[model samples]
Structures are given as C-alpha cells and as structure tokens.
Target: MKICHVNLASGYHGGENQTLQLIKQQAALGYELTVVANPKSPFVAAVRALPCRVVLANHYFAAHAASVTADCDLVHVHEGRAIYWALIQKLRHGVPYIVTRRIDNPLKKKWLANIAYRKASAVVGLSRDIVAKIQHAYPQLSPYKIPSSPVTYPIDETEVNDIRSRFKHRFLVIHAANMLQHKGFDVTIAAAKALQEQNANVHFALLGDGKAREQLETLAAGLTNVTFCGKQSNMGSWFAAADLQVHPSYTEGLGSVILEGLNSGLPVIASRTGGIPDIIDDHVSGLLIEPGDSQGLATAIMTVQANPQLRETLCAGAQQKLTSFRIEHTAELYQKIYQEVKSSL
Candidate 1:
C-alpha cells in the first residue's frame, strides 16, 4: 500500500518520534511511503535512510498546491496543521485520510475543524482520555484509541555509572520532559523542596529544555538537591541510573517518557490524569498522585525510596505492561486501520 504521511512540525518531539517509528515499521513491512514535511524539520533527516520519499512543504497550502497526495492510497495526518492539508486533498482529489490526535486538550468546535474531522476516514488518539475529549467535541465521530509505543535506546553502562557517580550517596529521581508549565516542572520543584527540607538523600534531576527553563530554574533556586540537566541526548543511560521517575504533569496525551522509565525497570510516580492511568496501574506498575499535589508526590517518592520490595514488584509489572505497547503492535493496528479505510472507499 502507498501512504502519504504528513507531519510538518519543525521540531522532533514525542509526536514526531511516534511518526518516525510508524514510518519505519510500515516501510519495513513493504509498504511504500511518502512523507509530507517541512524542509527544516528534523524529521526529514531522521527518515533520510528510510525507503520512502520526502515531500517538502512549509504549510498546508504549499503541500496542497504541490499535489503530494495525488497518487497515494491514503493520507495519515500526524499533526494538527497537517489535517487541513489532508482535508484539502480529500476535497479536491477524493483522497481518503486519517488523523492522529496526540493531545488531550479540548478540540475546538470551529466550522473548518468540524468539516475536516467529519471527512476523515479515521480519527485516532494516543490515549483513552484524548479519545473521550474528541468524542465530547464531536459526538458523531468515534475516534480510535491507539497509544504510542515505547522506544528503546542502547544503554551505555559507562555513561550510566558516570551519571550515578555524580550523585554519590543519593537516590536519583528523574523528571524528563520539556520544561513547560503543563509538564508540571513547578510541581516537581515544589516536591523537591519538600524532600530537601526533610534532609532526604534523594536528588531530583530535571531533564529537557524549553521556554519554561528559566522560569522553572528560578522556581527551583536555592534547592541544592535539584539539578537542571537540560536537554539530554542519552536518556537510556539516565533512566538506567535513576532510582525512580516522577512525572506530575497537569495533563498528558500519553506519558511516553514514563513508558521509557518503565521499560528501563524504574518504578514511576506520575499524575493521575489524561491517559497516564492507562499505562500506570496505581501502585502496581507505578504509583499515581493527583496533579499539582507536591506533598503527595513527595510522599510517594519517599514510600518508593524506603521500600525495595515494592519497587521490585512495580518493575515486574512494568515489563508486563510494556508487552501491549510494542512499536510492532502499534504499526499492525495502524495498518489495519489503513487497509479498512482503503477498502471502504
């Protein structure tokens, strides 16, 4: 099957990574693929060696005029703006398209959005919560719930030991995400402060950089236990060395980094919102706390820090949970959707 996958975002964040994974899997399965992306996007370089074509267009209008979707069997829109590109292709050439919504934010009820969604062959979400929100916005649409798969990176044991060595006699707690308000960096900092006040040996390592970095750093100031590591390229080593992962995001489409922590055998303490519950089984695979609850987050961290037996149990459960979220499984599900959408036409 020939598919035109559209993701015009410039940066390669979680959503872009998921798109790359899907394209890689589909291409390996002998499916011909064409990518409609911004020339400046890191995603283009990521797919450089793949057996697929790359069509460069800065915006939906440019993509439409370029006629990139003319010969494809179906179009898979991976980002919001790209949805309009698919919509125009559908309207102009009768090409079927599918949209994958990765955010849990409320879908806007604009006229163009309504038409674009209504005309989609399938609307997919990365979590059940996102799917619920989509349904709430458009009752006539039944969106598919297809979460992202966990990506495994090679662990450099030397690097892992080096990271662990920096925090001697300390239990490392990792919070990996873009330094954003919705990502709850402030909440994590508050929890770190509480832990520091208690003179705990736990160290909080805040990874990833964003516009909120300076603000988050200012909030974390005077806390010797908190360290801003900035954007990390070697996440596997950090996850391997960390004792636990704390992700207290106000909202999450699906906790992709949480999945990585779990895959690395680290017990996670994440917020009980969005599709997080779908991954964390509350005290089973990991512990769950209400969003913005700094005290609760600190308490959960202490509980896990004090109990080796509980951590082991959660790690065991983590491995079991990862089985259903393999990239191959995600690809197979999407291929099924693609085939169904194609056959229906």
Candidate 2:
C-alpha cells in the first residue's frame, strides 16, 4: 500500500513527531510512504534521512492537491489547512483520504471543517474529547475515535542516569511545553513561587522555547528554585532525572509529553482540560489540577514531594500504561485505518 502523509507546518512539534514515527514504523512494515511538506520547513529536512519519499510543494490548495493525488494511494493529512487541499483532491480524483485532528481549537470555521469531513474517507481524532467535539460540531461528520496512540518520544535511558548524577539528590520537577500563554507556563511559575514561599526544597526545570520565554523568566526572577533550560532535542535525561512532570496547559487534544513522562516512569501533574483527564486517572498514573490554578498546582507538587512511596506507585502505574501506546501499536492502528479506506475506495 502507498500512503502519503501531508503536513505543511514549519516547525517540529508533537504532531509532526508523531507523523514521522508513523512513517518510519509503516515503512519498516514494507509499505510505500511519501511525505508532502513545506519546502522551507525544518520538518521536511528532518524526514529526509528517513526511508520514505519526500515532496516539497507550494501551500496552494490546487497545486498541492494536483501534485499529491497522482502518485499516492491514500493521503493522510496531519494539519487542518492541508486537510482542505486533500479533500479537494479526493473529490476531484475519487481517491480515499484520512485526517488526524490533533488540537481542540474552537471550530470558528465549522463550515469548512464540515466540507473537509464530508470529502474524507475517515477522520482520526487523537483523543475521545476531540472526537466528541467534532461530533458535536458536525453531527453529520461522524469520524472514528482513535485516541492519540502512545509512543515513547526518543529518549535514551543512559542519558537519564547522567542527568540524575548532575542534579545530585535535588528534587527535580520538569515542565516540558512550548512557552505559550495557553500552555499555562505562567501558572507553573506562580506555583513554583508558592512552593518556594513555603520553603520547599524543589528545583523546577522549564523545557521548551517560544514567545513567552522572556516573560516566564521575569516571573521566575528572584526565585532560586527555577531554571529555564530552553529547548531540548533529547528529553530522556530530563525525564529520567526528574521526580515529576507538570503540564499546566489550558487545553490539549492529548498530552503527548505526559505519555512520554509516564513511559520514563515519572509521575505527571497536568491540567484537567481537553483530553488530559482521559489520560490521567487522578492519583492513578498522575494528578490533575484545574487549569490556571497556581494554588492547587503548588499544593499538588508539595504533596507529591512529601511522599516518595506515592510517587513510586504512580510512576509504576504509568509504566504499565505505556505499553498500550508503543510506536508499533500506533503504526498498526493507522495501517488498519488506511486499509479500510483503501478497500472502500
């Protein structure tokens, strides 16, 4: 089977990483794969080393559709704008296509989304919450619910031990997210401040880069417990060195970092928004706090810090859950979807 994965985004984030993982896994399974991406995107360069075909094209709907549809058996779109062009191509050529909705952005363009859904052979929702939202928005566009398949983000276990040696016995807390307002980095900083006020001996590490970095650094000013390490290419060491992972985002389709933290045996403290609650069973694998609640976040952090046994229990549960989201499992699910759509076509 020939599969074409389409993403026009310029930067590499969870969605692009997931798409790359899928492409690598599927190619290993002996399927022909092609990636349609932006010419100037770093993502395009990253995937060049992979064993798949890469096509750099203009972002125009008509041009991209015309170029992609001719040689591909199925087009799997990973972004909304690309979905529009893919739908147009599918309608024009009767080729089957699928889309993976990765965010919970309010559907301001509901009509356009509906049109794309109508043309798609299948829609892949990364989380059940997103699936519900899509169904609610366009009841006519019934898409399949395939919660974000879990995969361990590339992290080396050896580097984790090295990081632990560097931290030397200090209690480490990691927040790995883009420094965006909606990601709630401000709340995390405030929570760390609250912990420090209470004389807690904890070190907070911010891992990721974006527009809000300077503002977040200002918030962390005078606080000796916080460190902004900027963006990291390898997080295995960070996850391995940390006692806990905190994600205070206002929304998420599914927290892929939470899954990565769990796979690394780190307990997570995340916001109870979007599809986060589905992954964190409060006190089971991780703890959930209300979005933007600094006080609640601080208290949860302190509670986990105070109890080593509880942390161990949660981490163990997280490791067990990791098995369900292995890259192989996610690849198989996509393969099944591709097969079904192909048969229908």
Best by TM-score: 1
Please state the error at residue 240 of candidate 2 in Å. 1.5
**Weakest lDDT window of 10 consecutive positions for candidate 2:** 60-69
State in Å the error of residue 66, model 2: 5.5
C-alpha TM-score for every candidate:
0.97, 0.92
Backbone clash total for model 1 is 0
Model 1 vs truth, CA RMSD: 1.2
Q: For model 2, what is the C-alpha lDDT against the true structure? A: 0.81
Q: Candidate 1: lDDT over CA atoms?
A: 0.91
State the lDDT of candidate 1 residue by residue for 33-136, as single tens digits. Answer: 89989888889988877998888888887756535766789999999999998998888888999999998999998999999999999999999899999999
lDDT of 2 by residue, 1-345 (tens): 888888888777888877877787888889878888877677897779888888876573635545556777899999767887677777777667898999987565578777788778888787788888887777777777665555555567787777777666678899998898889889889988888868457778899999999988998899988889899978877876788899999999898888878887888999999988877888988899999999999999889999999999888877776666677877778788887887776
- Among residues 3 or more apart in sequence or in different chains, the pairs in candidate 2 whose N, CA or C atoms overlap within 3 Å are 126-148, 150-325
